[model samples]
Target: MADVSANPRADREENPLERQRELMELLSQETRHSIVQALLGHPKLLASSAELNHFVPSKSKKTVEEQLEVLVDAGIFALYEYPPNEDRRGLPWKFYGLTEYGADVLGDFNYLEGVPMARAVHRKTRKPEQIERHEAAPRPPLPESVRATFRLDEETD
Candidate 1:
């Protein structure tokens, strides 16, 4: 049998998780992350480097193109030249979209599903009983004189 290590396809198949991890690591960078997110949100759409400016507004066109090329080389995206019949420009626009593998990986991209309190963290609500139980410093009782002056000691029966 041929050594799987010698074959990139066989190596990727043998450890599919590794490929996913590699994809994630590459996307950990802000530019790459933005590019992937843009593609994911607009599947099957071919976006040129100029068009991608909205997704990565902070980056220059050159920087965006460089990152797009990196994603293209990684097999996460397929790059294509704009049709020749289109209006000519200084440089031919390159369009990019997710590859089959990229789409498959994106299908499994649910890393934020378990993100705790991402939506509710800002809203005020009753503190959980667990937190009160674990609190190191219990609140001190108000002095009777101070409570009486503020009528905080008044109780309705």
Candidate 2:
């Protein structure tokens, strides 16, 4: 569980950056990360627990349910109950979707698109030095014909 400050004034003062950091921490958990990615990727499409099981097949249902509750409590996920018109059973199964705030939060992190500078780190593989070297290297000159087509040759003249 994340630590909550008892002092309201103190909490207010510290919340701006801390809020984003807290969200990042929540997303850093692999299961939670996967859940968020799946939800965001699909937008408003509601996903049932059974459908979501595909994302974290290795985890027990209890664990996944608990995590879903955590996300719901955090306001990152919206839970939907089926309409009462249908003759459903006593216990209503819920479907999950990203809340508006959830979509904004995930968008802020560029979670759907690949991370800009972090793409080099794949599957826990870190090659910071290589990434730095790649960035520092200059691009090769464009072919003259291609450049001429774009009127770059006139710019030089």
Candidate 3:
């Protein structure tokens, strides 16, 4: 019989760039990146569609669903049903968490294995005082004419 156990590191040592490229492609999209980050931070926390929707509020439901599908297809997440409970229809809601492969990828220490730019820069630069002061010093609201042109529900089909 052929050897069933092979050292995984052999492949990475053989083609590190290719593996890095694959990882980067998987996390290229902002929504996809956010989903991965969320799962990474809370591995055991099952995130539902609604929870994901709230986590990435700027994205539409359709977009969030698409991201979840992509992650599942990439083998980064697994889907499972929530247990039946009161005040709920118990309809199967997709929950996502990192797979073994995902954990391995995340654990990889190579800098090339992730987005080229670090997300920490944005967080470090945005001080709470800046946000609070900006919030308190809000400028005039949008003009009525511009407000009339804006429709929150308007979306491209």
Candidate 4:
């Protein structure tokens, strides 16, 4: 009943790009995709929920939270929490980083890092006030993995 010329694959039982199509569909959502991009561009490859939220300040925090949950469920992200011993008298500090698979997938978009401010690495292109706010934001100690990756070790006395 369908026109074969107009819909050649309509009757096909299998699609060669099914997996990639599914992944694309999942990442098609702007916010979801942006979250991944932000992480991939980060110098330490990690950020807190609060810090990440700043990148999309217009969106409701709950939206970011839910998207993060979805990414974690999809195995694209790993949540890192600050140990209680170093707790800062508030809610547990939550940081996020990509899984190995996530990094591999992100490699497919290496060209995206050429945007303004060079993939959001330096905030110099941002409004001066915005930069001020970001600088003033609380920077909880980065996880040890990030420290080692960025080589921020303390000198032994």
Candidate 5:
């Protein structure tokens, strides 16, 4: 295996923003980003999918699972398999935490400010369709009664 400490020539050639964008694309959803942020806050700590569900209450199990797979594939998270003796009769429960690269990217954001990892990630992962959906489908206008109830122009005399 090649020395892991040294950056590959290819990686060196890529611009920093591009790399951050790739990382962000891997962590696109709110749930996935929350998971990574939580792990960054607590390094090397393993969190089960159930635990993750608790952390991101809005996301469904299937959604979280998909995000976790993406993170694992992107090398942002390390998945650990539980020993057979620990739990039997079901699929092995996997715990995930941030990898060294994940940590570095997060750390560089908090400490260095040398690169905008979060923005880059958002830019890379955000799709034009997604933007259009959000923009085109504005929320329904508030009920007239509800709107009248909180009129900013009317002042208590």
Candidate 6:
């Protein structure tokens, strides 16, 4: 075994490079890479979850959503949801956009459309409790408080 006195941090402590490695591993997967690539070339740099599904037709809706959730959790994507329809009959539009950090990672690493490096896929195993919670959890509600208000002369939407 190597000497331990030189290192101060514990074995479990995460450093910046490790986090980036985690992200690279996440993005290296085929389905996840497709999702990122689609957004990279998009005009708005954003896409609805359903739209991302088109990029990876081989995967099911649930799989795409799961991958989107992972990206969202990793802070690589910011989710914007549209209001529910009248009577709240169906799911709201959950649009995922590339966050600034996401854009930087893509640009810096040349992961554009992927495939320069050999794929090292990563899939985290889930515990039973985690699986149950993830399946049962409701979509997170939008914030109710307004921090700032600004007027815009032009409305794109």
Model 5 misses residue 112 by how many Å? 11
For residues 75-129, what per-residue lDDT tens digits would candidate 1 score against the true structure? Answer: 5566655445245533334556555545445545752332223223312333344
Choose 4 or 5, whichever is better by TM-score.
4
Alpha-carbon lDDT of model 6:
0.51
What RMSD value applies to candidate 3? Answer: 17.4
Clashing pairs in 2: none
Off by over 4 Å in 2: 1-14, 84-93, 114-157
TM-score of 6: 0.55
Q: Point to the candidate with the largest TM-score.
A: 4
lDDT of 5 by residue, 23-135 (tens): 55655567777766543322124455655555556788888888887776665565755554245433324566555554455555552242235335433543344332322
TM-score of 5: 0.53
* Candidate 2 least-lDDT 10 residues: 1-10
Q: What C-alpha lDDT do the candidate models reach, one value each?
A: 0.50, 0.52, 0.49, 0.55, 0.49, 0.51
Candidate 6, run of 10 with poorest lDDT: 144-153
Compared with the true structure, model 2 gives a TM-score of: 0.56
Question: Backbone clashes in each candidate structure, one number apiece?
Answer: 0, 0, 0, 0, 1, 0
Q: After superposition, how far is residue 122 of candidate 1 from its true place, in Å?
A: 26
Task: Indicate the residue-level lDDT of 134 in model 5.
Answer: 27
Model 1 regions lying over 4 Å from their true place = 1-11, 88-93, 111-157
Q: lDDT tens digits, residues 1-157, model 4? A: 1111132223343773765566576676788877776665554556667656776666788999899887776655677555552465443355676654454444444423443343455343253454334334344454464355334465231
